[model samples]
Target chain A: MARATGCLAVSLGTALQICLLFGTASLLSVGGGNSVVPEIQLRAVDTYHWLSAAQFGDLFAIAQAAPGPSMLLVTLVGYKAGGVVGALLATVAMILPAGVIVHVVARFWQSSSGARWHVAMERGLAPVAIGLVAASGAIIARTTEHSPAQLALTAAATLVLCATKLNPLFLVAAAGIAGWLGLV
Target chain B: MSRDRPSSDVSLGRLAATFCQIALASFGGGLSAWSRKVVVEDRGWMTDEEFLSAMTLCRVLPGANQVNLAIYVGSKLRGPRGAVAAVLGLIAVPVLIVLVLGYLYFRNGSVPATQSILRGITAVAVAMTFAMAYKTGAKALRSLPAWVLCAASFLLSAVFRVPLPVMLAIVAPVALWWAWPARPDASP
Candidate 1:
């Protein structure tokens, strides 16, 4: 009985921690979902020891492989640590604060019509967002596999993606086939 | 390709269902395009201009851009309750699906075949990011100052390994100042 109670206590505590951790992540996520990945790593892997860096990477891959938003990886993280309850807590905590901010800001923007700063802010941030997104891409490439074939493939992809209108998912599937066959 | 923009009385249920469809459809990136097709063209919830501007804002703000966008669109349509409904619809299903995938991965993570497949996919995923960079970066890579800013921002985070928020703090003010709307009567 005591051990079961202890287990419950620990899980509840960890679930709460997941909430706070993700809440902080949402607030600090300046660039986008991908931007806060390292922070998520720091918390889930480093601080909490819920999963190793490799496991975190695997979860990311799975999230990518599975259909849906990339941010759903947080659900994986939560489930790994504390099961379904943890996943629910993490997802809610991760989005609610940010959602409220968007809501409140939208309200503010609606009320403050004709605000000149709005357009200026949008114009200025557009370029910054663009650069940061590229930076994010670079970071992902660097952090993921960096074998020679992968590097060559990435280079090829860069040229092709910039030039062509082909869908990326098809390329991803092709790459998977090559990988499965030990080509890449 | 669907040409049916929803009528103006976007109920909370309709908002939820629409975002839910977007969430399910967007896989392996292209969330933005999917959102555009649905929100701007399909529902006419927002004009193209409104959609573009909101997208830029979503990217600029914190959290997931898509999720933030859902919030923005919902709030624009029907305030806080709408925002909640939209986000729930967008994520609830995806979360369950991802967790199931995670479970399978955890169970079979040691398999050689699984590892190999992941290996290939990871490489391609990296490439997609590069492609994403190029696609988005082209827009801002037009002018000299924009190029300089892009390079500086890119180098700071990608090359120099600076944290994103820190780089944002350093770059945002200068970039904004440079992009400040020019006076109408200013000399050409």
Candidate 2:
């Protein structure tokens, strides 16, 4: 009976630890989910010893490929630490604080709509935002593209998407087939 | 081109389903593009200008850009409950999928051989992002100062790899100054 109680306590403690680690990471991830990847890796792999480095790498691949936000990486990490419950806790911790901040800001933005400063903000920020979007593309290209063929695919897709109103899903599907066939 | 604006009275279920579709459709990457398509183009929930600015605000703030976006759009449309619904829709299915993948990886001791397919998809994903940039830029980059600010932001972010906060610190002030609305009484 005592052992059982001790085990329960340890699991609860582990869950709490998951919350704390991910909660802090949630606030620190200013540049999006990828910003905190290294921090997560260092803590989870090096400090906590929850999983091997290889496992972390694989999870990252899985997260990127599985769809949705890659920040779901936290879910996997939490799963490793505490199973289903840990995963839920980690996810909530990761999103709640940051989500709250964005929500408040969104409300404020809405309330200030059509004001002169708001107009200034909308215009001034639009250019910078578009720039960041393009920068993300450049960064992703540098990291993901290896061969000239892949580069050509990206370039061609960009041109097609820009000039035409073609749905991008078709291009993405074709690229996948090319990859599966080892064409690119 | 700003057009008819959709009402924010979107039902919670619709918000959830819409975000769910957006999340699932972003297979390789470019979740942001998928978001813009659904939120601005298909649904008409927001104009290009509103969406662009909201996106930057989300990026500048903490957390995952997609999740933050989900929160922003959801809250705008339906308040706190809407935000919850959107986030759940966006992540619930994907989280389960990722968990399954994690299980398989841990069990089988290796990722399944989807590397090549992912490679191709990743390339397209990059393209999707570039396309998003081009599409939005055509509308936003109308002025020389706007072009300069966009270029500076792009260079700082892509080439110098300046951190976002620092880049924003350097560029935002100039952008705000240039874009500040002229006093109605004083300026032409």
Residues B155-186 of candidate 1: C-alpha lDDT, one tens digit per residue:
88778988766887898788777766676332
CAPRI-wise, candidate 1 is medium
Give the interface-residue alpha carbon RMSD of model 1.
4.1
Off by over 4 Å in 1: A1-25, A28-65, A69-73, A80-82, A107-114, B1-62, B105-113, B119-141, B183-188
Worst 10 residues of 2 chain B by lDDT: B1-10
Candidate 1 chain A worst ten-residue window by lDDT: A1-10
Write candidate 2's Cα lDDT for B123-153 as tens digits.
9889889999988888889999999999999
lDDT of each: 0.71, 0.88
Report residue B153 deviation for candidate 2 (angstroms).
0.4
DockQ of candidate 1 against the true complex: 0.50
- Cα lDDT tens digits, model 2, A1-184, are 0112112133767777788899999999997989999999998899888888988998887888898999999988887777777778889999999999999999999888877778877889899999999999999999889999999999999999889888888988899999999998
